[model samples]
Target: MSSLPPASFQTPRQIFAAFDRGDLSRESFREAMNEHALQLIEEMEEVHQNPVAAWMEHLRSRRAAGKLGREYGEAMVRELLVALSEVPEFPLARWIWNADRPHLPLYCFLRPKAEPVFRIQKIVCAPFVVMVRVEYGSSEKSATVREKFTFTRDQVGRLRMSGRERVK
Candidate 1:
């Protein structure tokens, strides 16, 4: 189970004020953000199990070509991650930073290091430059990774249509 900060904790505005005033250490702010992220993950898991169950059901329906397209997008993201992991760290960061890419659709994997629980699914129309974060609860450790593979006009044109029109 993920542990969250107490409800009486400072709000984002308050935290930002402290940060701006140099009253809050950067490390403390980071830890707070990590905690907030874990809480969000917990909430998302709840929704995935219930309120969002309909979405999963829709994934099985006959009119799910959009979902199929999302699956393909996810496969592309996985391939990208695998390729990124192969590159040396510094060079990969430099390349990603310098690359002018547009946002592509994505699927994400969230695994809890302390537990056997994991979630994997597609995100529709997510920006390519968005941050990806991995958190380890036991050690209160986290890492973020971002990619810069935006789709060019020509690349968008090459995407498989699957009878359904591309989402604008």
Candidate 2:
């Protein structure tokens, strides 16, 4: 009954535009972003090249060409830069950026109208444990978040997070 387009056929930019125009519900947009992020993670895992760096450069070019708004473009660039630096851990980093962050996918929701910037302060990857320290927020307010995750392989041999906790 809804008028929303199929998320599988739309790019993240298209989904964002649809949400901005009131054509897509908030929850739908979130799901679409999740799907897109997952697909990107899978693709990044398969590539041997530095796709993350290429992606960041592409974003910069898009911003330079005025395809994306200034604030939104800058914010995305910052987020992608962090992901690029994270390399083999880029999948988890990208997931955290897109899925773990509550206020993402809707940049206009920030109270003070400042674009958020994301930075990964530390990442320690052990045998079955991952600890990441990240700082993200707008100029007005920011948060340093640390998360620990224990991972294990599933029956199908796909790596999965067995447990996760926000470290205080």
Q: Which has the greatest lDDT? A: 2
In model 1, the Cα lDDT at residue 48 comes to: 69
- Cα deviation in Å at residue 149, candidate 1? 48
- The residue-level lDDT of candidate 1 at 164 comes to 18
Task: State the lDDT of candidate 1 residue by residue for 1-168, as single tens digits.
Answer: 333234345444445667889987999888765765675587568656675553543343323334434555545444433333222331222112211133432212223232222222333334332222222223232332222322221244332212211121
Model 2 spans with C-alpha error above 4 angstroms: 1-114, 139-146, 155-158
Candidate 2's TM-score reads 0.29
**Where does candidate 1 clash, by residue pair?**
101-150, 102-150, 103-128
C-alpha lDDT values of all predictions = 0.37, 0.44
Q: Tell me model 2's lDDT, rounded to 2 decimals.
A: 0.44
Best by TM-score: 2
lDDT of 2 by residue, 75-146 (tens): 443343333333333223432334224355322211121123433445444544444454434333335334
Q: Per the 3 Å backbone cut-off, how many clashing residue pairs does candidate 1 have?
A: 3
